[model samples]
Target: MGGPDVLATWSTGEHTGAALDGKSLTFPTYRKGTGPGVIVIHEIPGLTPQVVAFAEEVVAAGFTVVLPHLFGTPGKGLSPASLATAFRQVCVRREFTKLATGTTSPVAGWLRSLARDLHDELGGPGVGALGMCFTGGFALAMMVEDTTVAPVLCQPSVPFAVTPGRSRDLGLSPADLDRVKERAAGGCQVLGLQFAKDPMTGRRFDTLERELGEAFLRVDFPGMKHGTVTIDRQQEGVDRVLGFFAEKLH
Candidate 1:
């Protein structure tokens, strides 16, 4: 976690908490900006400064952004220690399906609820959803809800990629996959970003290409960077995501 202290300047915005399934799911969330809503899910090390900076970028792009603090220290920077701490929490947390194949992380239900609430309040076609790193495939899973119009997956690394089967898994169950496929076929487009050689992302991108066909917008960079919109950010990737949100939501 050796990085600039960008968090000091990060806007606190409107902080609140959300719950679903009575008390089965709950997480603190921060919101800012105004217009079409977008949920920016943070990576493995939790809501690090880079993630916050990226969220601010989304906010500046003229969209309302809601950031759910899933784990780790919100203002902390990325480091080996921070990553390990968050990884442990992910493994122990029932809300996440880290190494489970053909399973949609249980937290997605709460996220879908958040998306629905945002859409209901904003009264738009739908809200945009973007998940990075460990939560990457979440944006795709969130698409099961019609409230998610624009879905962006940035190097979705889950199910750990310890085996071939895990590598190809989209971190979603069969039923959810069917719904996502139907949505794709019915004109919902999914955008995915990853480094061409990133092992963490494994074959999930290929799986997405096959499943969604032309509706899957693929953006691959040349190096092995994992976080496309945060840590090892690419300006083009960020621009593409903002453009996508504008097209689908506005």
Candidate 2:
């Protein structure tokens, strides 16, 4: 744990054959630390140095952090080419819903299952889920399962923000949105972070506020930056996420 640029070696594991509706997905996962489990879902360019650095911060804060390799090359730093390639892949994959509104990305089901298994194994109040950039809204969608007690969305950027309507979309189907509302009412708190003028995030925070009311805790900084906890690396945003996890998961 030297720093964000220099990280400790991760204990690798594979989520072999994890499926939803008969659609199976297998990817490499990285784990470290010891405490309540927190699943750190990476953003568009995959698990870049910044993303892993943030996860290491979580580990240092005393929680077991599991990072799943969704796309891009692990350990590779973020770059324009990497971002373009990952975004293109997400668009082509059936697992993600890029421009569609009111639909949960099919990949969310697999992530929910992963959350459930982690919570079951760790056994506590529940697990914390933090999804960044392209996968940000996933934490909310993962709330469909009881195991995801603390959901953090840092610059969610889903449904691709291609249109005004899509920008406002939370990337949850109507049914899943209702489930999330119910979970919020039942005491689940969702933490969202974004730059105040980040176009990629659109008005999804407004949607979260409208739907979840006080349960949607948001941290909007003053800028046009998108990746609040990753490439942008806002220290306050990182501290806020760690604090939110501490209050909810511990």
Candidate 3:
């Protein structure tokens, strides 16, 4: 988990907590000069130092940033070691249908609720959601509640898991996708980012981008791997995100 200094302390305020999904969600929040609300959803590895640094960068751009610990509390954060191991196992476990089918899980509901709470706290009509990796599509799901909830689905997964029973759980129901399309037609933009080498996100980015049309802003970082966006906040993608939020939310 060690890496370069991607964040300056002055960029953000402090880390805080909120109750969500029966867990004490620890978030690295920044609220200095207010403009728009931004909710940062962490990858499967949970809210690591890298992710918090990215949230800080967002705050520096003049937005209220909330990095929710969708997994759990601070120290209880997901272990990178274990996550890496699990990812490896998934790669080898050919019978891991559970992993794919688990896409229709209830995680999206919790995220949507948190977005609502953040909107309430920020005193805005709605807020923006940024989801990465495992939770990437959650942002899109949040938009199902309202089009005003601009979402950035960074490296979304589980596209082939679409089914009637698991649709709502996995953040892809017919009605929800239809609503998102409608929003896009009306002018809501959904952005996505992925490393060119990350097979998990790269494969579906183009397809989803095509399906989403003008609403989808797809960016690829050549030679970069999975989880690099947060790992390298100084990168152009990160900067674009900051600027995008500053412009859209403000």
Across 1-250, the per-residue lDDT of candidate 3 in tens digits comes to 4322333332443433332234433335333335677888777656566677677677777777766544423322347674775456435532212244323334555556666666767765578888887777778777766624568877665443244333223346566667777887877888778777765653566555666786788788776566656654438788777767756776
lDDT of 3: 0.61
Question: TM-score for every candidate vs. truth?
Answer: 0.92, 0.95, 0.72
User: Mind giving the per-residue lDDT tens digits that candidate 2 earns over 128-232?
Assistant: 999988889888889998999999999988888888899899998899999999999998999999999999999999999999999999899998987888778
How much lDDT does each candidate structure score? Answer: 0.87, 0.87, 0.61
RMSD of each: 2.5, 2.3, 6.4
Misplaced by over 4 Å in model 3 are 1-34, 72-104, 159-171, 232-234
1 against 3, candidate with superior lDDT: 1
Candidate 2 regions exceeding 4 Å error are 1-8, 17-20
Model 2: colliding residue pairs: none
Scored by TM-score, the top model is 2
Candidate order by decreasing TM-score = 2, 1, 3
Give residue 200's lDDT in candidate 1 (0 to 100).
Answer: 95
